[model samples]
Target chain A: MSQVLTIDGKDLAFDSGDTLFDVAQAQGIYIPHLCHHPDYPPQGNCKLCTVDVDGQSKCACTTQAETGMSVQTDSTTLTEYRRALTELLFSEGNHHCPGCERSGNCQLQATAYAQGMTYSSFKLLNPQRQIDASHPSVLLDRDRCILCGLCVRASAQEGKHIFTIAGRGSDSTLAVNSDSGLLADTNLSAEDRATQVCPVGALMVKQQGFRIPIGQRIYDQGTIDDLGNRRPQYHSPKSKTARIAGDSDD
Target chain B: MTESTTDSRSLTRVAIDPLTRVEGHGKVTLLLDENQVVQQARLHIVEFRGFERFIQGRPYWELPMVVQRLCGICPVSHHLAAGKAIDMLVGAEQLPPTAEKTRRLLHFAQVLQSHALHFFHLSSPDLLFGFSSKASERNIVGLLEKHPETALKGVKLRKFGQQLIETITGKRVHGSLVVPGGINKALKPAEINVYAKQMDEIIQWSTEALELAQGLYQADRKHADFGAIGSPTLSLCGNNGNFELYHGDLRVKDIDGTILLDHISNRDYLAHIEEEVKSWSYMKFPFLKRLGKDRGWYRVGPLARVLNCQQMDTPLAERARLELVNQCYPDQHQSVLLYHWARMIELLHCAESIQQVLKDSELTGGELVAPHGDRNPECYGIIEAPRGTLIHHYKVNDQDLVEEANLIVSTTSNNQAMNEAIRSVCRQYIDGHGVSEGLLNHIEVAVRAFDPCLSCATHALGKMPLSVEILSVAGHETQVLERTSQGEIQQRFYPC
Candidate 1:
């Protein structure tokens, strides 16, 4: 029997083992997530998709939908929490939006805009990060990374196992699995799912930046609420089989 | 601080800090003796932003977009200049015809809008209402209240230019259009058509604005002598020695219209140009290396371009240029006020050029980027920004990150000339008078004629204020007068 749950006062039906996020997404309700991609196993690292389930705040991406469960996807308290989480993400890294190639198309930037986050109130860490551009077709700028692990999962799913998260807590960073710690030594190609799954400018294809123009960019057309996880795909010569994240079935 | 000029009389220092109606923060100081005779005058730029150092260790391709942060008023100029430099870095000696034309179009729009803004909004009040008019009456708001039609036309003209930039570059300010070897996108015919339909109105408005500036200059005899100083002028000229805003060799002309240097290439700029660091100001003084610092100081911008170039390429601007030349009998063009007239003529030229470029079929369809050439370590991008000549020089290491960067912005190039202009104004108007509103306005008017961008010159960022401090003969603070960034004036006196 199909399980029914109440989300934001709407009764939604879901199958067994389906997460609250997946059920809401299937019913055309966007939970405003960054690290949670539909194609990959929900990591629930970014708690932006926090919802009040039965008077308890929980990560919608990890919480399984149950029969007769009440879930509030959005509220004043949840918005404040989401905004604080977004601000913390910004303050934890050096995110210079103007200089970033993914400025208008970045999901992090779009999500921040949707949450009405104009500036970060927390003290910025300004952590120094590394840039790995050894790969001819792709560049890895750790400064823009949010530790989404989408790339780590995507690379593992592709059987390349090129990316892995290293360190812990505030020191955690997206690291390459190659022995030399360089992207050139990895088996990842520009067409690899790992290269295509980056939600930010962390893993960008070389020579394809600022091509879509400003107003025509993914987020520029509409807010993240209106266009959830839709990115303008730039097809490189070697990117014939590359797919945009959340667009194709796993 | 005050200095004793003679046994009986001592020099009192008067400073106008944070000069108003300009892009950045700067000040002017004059020393007066007991007789109220002007002893010395200097323009001080107060902040420094080391942009060249900031770009170090970054990839070379990012220079075009990265350098736009230098100035909000003229980011397009920086973008294009850096693009030209990056083109050389990637070994693109020649851009595709379409790429070249598109860049030119963007530059013309930039110049058009910048000139309109300076004239209609920044300096028009002084010209229309008189430089010595009531402080409250000499502003954009005042202009709008009295002359709404003219103010509206100025706004629309500036809007047209900005919209044109947005259409081409995507965003109005700090937008990305130029890439390494060429532009990122082509100008579609529909986009061209949108601007093409507005060309007639744009040209008409520009022509009317030019007439207003000319009429104002002719009507006021005082303008002829206001801040007049003799100096050598510099700008870029076409291969044939015609007025060229984009892609040209350097040309320098003396006060007598003698060519000091001509056809100097961008790569050889180091050999011809050099910057001198001064103890007082963050801005550097750039002059012709051949002439040395004492004599090499030259003027730049619309006045310099008009004086240095032989003729304008477009017919309308050429006619206006000739009229200006005829009005300035021999040495009359040396008047600082002529910058407004020359700037309006260039505005007309840009308007005509924009219309001409839109008709070009190459913009609709052609090769976007040029084929790569042998990569080089060092390259220079030089272009005539709205204010004056802008130079961007960069050297990249083997890893493609920028190893070094040196920029000589337009305002920095005119630093020495601005000081000279202020000195001339002090000697002419403030020689025997106390610090009055009219006298202070005269000083500001002199500096405004140059259309200086202190922010771009210092590579700094912040709002600017105007303050006047009177120092006693003993070097003790006697009185202070300040004009805040919000245009509020506060005066304080200290008992000796």
Candidate 2:
């Protein structure tokens, strides 16, 4: 038997082995975060997940739950820090969310809203990205990439190395094997890139244009957020990662 | 103990994660002795494409569009294969007369592009340069740097094919217009003339390309030994017994050089052929297993086509093919190594096929798709896409909803044999003492010998990983979904 914990003076109950974030979720409370998909590997690198625990700011994903523990999800201090973190990530890459295709569905946009971020203080990194129209199935717009390395990881771990990161940290980007330096020359296949995985418009369907009517678009009937980022909530069954992860959930 | 000696249990297994520089991700493992004699070879065809069975509930017209998703590199193949099968299922004469001509043109266009891709992209590396180039320069770029004129010719030829595909199907890659029972559009005479011009240029260039291949063959003899799957190669060139690329009578030859099958109607394939399931791979091997042999590995596609046909239509390709056969000494090498040379020869033939089809009487002006009063309850289709022979069979019920489907793609035709070819290369080339990227790549590329649309052969990409929960279908009145990726379930409200 595990004792219940209180967060922000409210009683929250969870299983003994649940992570802090998992416990927070069971209470119907949320903490602003990105790079923390339940199905994907959690790195807690977003830094926006900082929460107040014993007067210390810590990531909720990696930290374990404790009995009689008191915590706050959105304190004044934590909110300010999270907003700052969002602003910096925005400035680090050329994530012009408004014009981006991934604008509505992107995690970066969702995190910014959650933290109540208004604007950025730092200038944009303004990295140049090549749009490959070679492979007929999908397109890869590099400028929108936040370097979350989700695609890189997906291609390597799940995709089993059909794609790879060719360079070093800041200098690195996902590169295909074709000499054309574009997807057209590489061996990138349709199944390699599913339509719904990308949060932003960075990866768009190339071959089938406007076949998905605006009324029936993925974002049309329900905002995944309003629906919840859980199965039948945040995840689309067509996503390769979501589908692969679905087995473990069962 | 048979030939090569030493530790028997320690077989060298090479895991080419995503096996690069080839179509689809799959791996090959080889068992051998210290003496280097090969034992068992297994090809793990990992991507599950179940295209054959997925179309049971879909519209007959959507089959071509859906089937096109099977291969990213050769969408036109499935589109044409499905179209041909649907046309036959409705009875060829029942189809709108113009539909047949348009389908043929589309088929030729696909052959042109696919054959060109094989020569330029898949097989050229081995022929244009040493098969193992450490320079890491492997692509059209590499081809251009070494031989600019040849690369340009290939680009032009392939582009011409794409133009024709786009013109007829309305899109370049995943074309959706080719309908069952008939086509969706017709090739205009003006468009036909342009295609003819492009075909003329392609014919000249591909002929020269074949000549260059002949010149290169004297220097490259090893390629002649690739994919020599036991005995006679399974082939589907043209039923006319000509080395044509469009319609064909399916044929299989035994190792004794006897024709086991001279004609195979699409409806009879199931009774004559059967697919064997293997736990080691996702690909199901189709064999004349009904013949009661040890599940004989049957092959169909380029190598099979070259072995099956004795004559080609294009004068230039016919001459080159004759020369290619004469040069092989014992003549059996025609199926073994000629797949590479045959692609170039087909490029020459496709160039001619494209030119002739464009001149057909119906393409100048005629109706495209035929009238569909209702869905046919059952139909079967078989046509030659660039990859090889393709088959689609469907069964529909009273309301015209689909009931059952079975597909046999060109890739399935070679599944078991591909495993055999990989082992042969492993024993001959790979060094277990160390990992040789070069040796590993050549063997992997050998699977490309069939140019399989791993996904296309499986079916298409519209597949969803749906998790169906069968909660005792509520009552005995619940309908049985005879076919579903989700297994069968009975109706009952038996709760936990």
| DockQ for each numbered candidate | 0.40, 0.01
Please give, for residues B323-358, the per-residue lDDT of candidate 2 as tens digits.
765654355433234566766777777777767767
Error of 2 at B157 (Å): 0.9
Q: Which stretches of candidate 1 lie over 4 Å from their true place?
A: A235-250, B1-10, B20-23, B327-329, B452-465, B483-492
Candidate 1, residues B374-445, lDDT tens digits: the string is 887899899999999989999987656788999988888888887887777877777777777577678777
A105-193: candidate 2 lDDT, tens digit per residue: 45667667666777887777877766454554556666665555555555555554545557786787756655667766755555552
Q: Candidate 2, residue B197: CA error in Å?
A: 3.0
